[model samples]
Target: MHATPLTFIGASVSWGKLRSAVTTWQPLGVVSTISVRAPFLNTIRLSSSIHHTEETDVAAIDLDEANLILDILHRFQEELGAISDAGDRLKQSRSPEVDEYRRRLVNVKGELKNAAKSGTLDGVKRPQTELERCFYGPAVQHAAAHFRLRTDAPPSMWLSGLYDPAGDVSYYTHGLRKLVDEGQII
Candidate 1:
């Protein structure tokens, strides 16, 4: 008897997805993975007849659609600060600033509705530095509602929870959580 090797991609949505598939491996089936980051990543691969590629969509997102929504949501920050700031009561009594924010808020809300109708989601790498975290933290908050998920609805944050603002930080939302339990990204 001859042994053949099967390799799994390291960047799958989650290890839970591959748990059952790996258990079915026979002695002759050599399971292998290529990973430099996560030691245990890349352990699941479909055999020649395990499943079709389309099935993987269950773990993936429609980037175009989610990106549109996310993009619009965060754009509200262009004038002064984001709507999260408003929620945080960061908006001052100055009439001009308040009015601008109100105007932008209405605009962004309508746009987000359009985006929800229009589409889904894709993966985003976790921020590693303080500045990166600070910058993306708000985006994470803006996009957090999309995280809980719904049938056929595009995901908002596919990566691990990235924006848990500290009590001392300016914002207060819980932030985005992992879409998959484990193994979504690096």
Candidate 2:
């Protein structure tokens, strides 16, 4: 008798929801509450009927919102840099922050570097595992949200819509991809 391999499924569903939220949500517009009805196996069902609303078109987001998102991304990048620099300093000597976050950053960086060197960063060759997919889902969504709110275009548009906003998202995504490619959380 041959036994079948049972695959874990919940992570994919969660990832899908997160991905949808990222791709569809607008920065300034409020996202309608999604209600799931009926128990469908391996399917995401929203209770609210999906209908075409007039707000689907991507417009120029306000300057204030764009500036706010840009500020947040810049801050996040600075935090990552501080942590990384502190870790480097610890390796050479020692520091107070090393005891808490710096050391952790060093360890994570090493692990991610190794993972990348081992060719695990190639998305086509080896897809991100369920855990990774779940972890990245939120980061991507948050970045996208920042882009959407900060950008003056529809959510359906890619990062190339607005010049300054697009540049911000590009920088943010570049940093984010570095951490992800290294297999570390941002």
Candidate 3:
């Protein structure tokens, strides 16, 4: 499958420090923006013509897949939040060893938020590294498994197997093979 690219725009923080007779505090507001582009012309596709052939089953499968994707996205978001929280705590503690970790975490968190704002997490952007791609493979495979297909089955096979013969048989199969050959898939 073709993957889209994501571009980060900018980030901003709002709010000012408040000082009282004996204490000072600041509440920060961070806003990040990004743009998500799809490699495919269409973001979503449905086989309407064949719906009548197996409407109920197909609809159920689609719903299950959608829910699975949503769960994965939620988990990803939670992971990012945990990373950000950990960084914030480390920064507050002022620990020497955590200094480097904090910086890296903050940077990664920012990038992730920017990507999310840009809708990249919606499956628009293809992962830049094989590791990242593999990280998300389980989620894809979960959806496929719900459809009673092999975990390594091409995504198109689980989605619209008959309609996109070329995609299911050639592009996806070849892509998987290439990934395996290059050690991108394990």
Candidate 4:
């Protein structure tokens, strides 16, 4: 059995994607074909048959898209802060912030949906998943805490549920802030 070692040239490959591709390897034929792209190196696709190559659309987030996502995250912080303003109010109507929170949620969902529908998601790639989880994890915790507070549950019930979403917002924004601070994003 002869193995055709693949060589990547003119571009770099993401290790995570490379690892996943190699793990699912199958010997389709004696001669294996590999596709490599330049610039925004995404992944490597291994196949036994010849494959067509296409120009890769750059996976980048525009300033407007980045700001919209950041705005939603910032609103999450405001909602958490006002949870106590109407201590007696139900979670559904506790504060106007909740309504605004829901609105922002819908707004983001819409933006993503529209982007996908237009085949433009490649152009608006959101931040990396790890960074996204930073915001999402805390948001979930804060929501749980808010629910517990509304239900009059004992503090111990959600002792570990108090997470500040702004931590992630600031963490992510810090990088962007630096870029702008240095006149990089003007």
Summarize candidate 2's per-residue lDDT along 69-172 as a digit string, tens digits.
Answer: 23333443444445445444455444454456534433333322332332211112233333223332233334334332222222222223222333433464
The C-alpha TM-scores of every prediction are: 0.28, 0.29, 0.25, 0.31
> All candidates' lDDT scores?
0.28, 0.31, 0.31, 0.33
Please identify which of the two predictions, 1 or 4, would achieve the higher TM-score against the true structure.
4
lDDT (Cα, tens digit) per residue for candidate 3, span 1-186: 433222211222122232111211112222222121111121212111111122222211222223223333343334334433444454345456455544444443333333333232233443432222332344333322222323233322323321222122233234444544565422
| Model 3 / residue 110 / CA error / Å | 6.6
Ranking of all predicted structures according to lDDT, beginning with the best and ending with the worst: 4, 2, 3, 1
Q: Which stretches of candidate 4 lie over 4 Å from their true place?
A: 1-58, 84-161, 180-186
Q: Is candidate 2 or candidate 3 better by lDDT?
A: 2
The order by descending TM-score is 4, 2, 1, 3
Who wins the TM-score comparison? Answer: 4
How would you encode candidate 4's per-residue C-alpha lDDT over 78-135 as one tens digit per residue? Answer: 4433433322243445456555544443433332233233221122233322223333
Indicate the residue-level lDDT of 109 in model 2: 34
* Candidate 2 ranges beyond 4 A from true positions: 1-56, 92-96, 103-170, 173-186
User: Which stretches of model 1 miss by more than 4 angstroms?
Assistant: 1-81, 87-94, 121-176, 179-181
Model 1 lDDT, residue 52, Cα: 17
TM-score of 4: 0.31
Candidate 1, residue 119: Cα displacement in angstroms equals 3.3
Model 1: what TM-score?
Answer: 0.28
As for TM-score, the candidate ahead, 2 or 4, is: 4
**Considering TM-score, which of the candidate structures 2 and 3 is the better prediction for this target?**
2
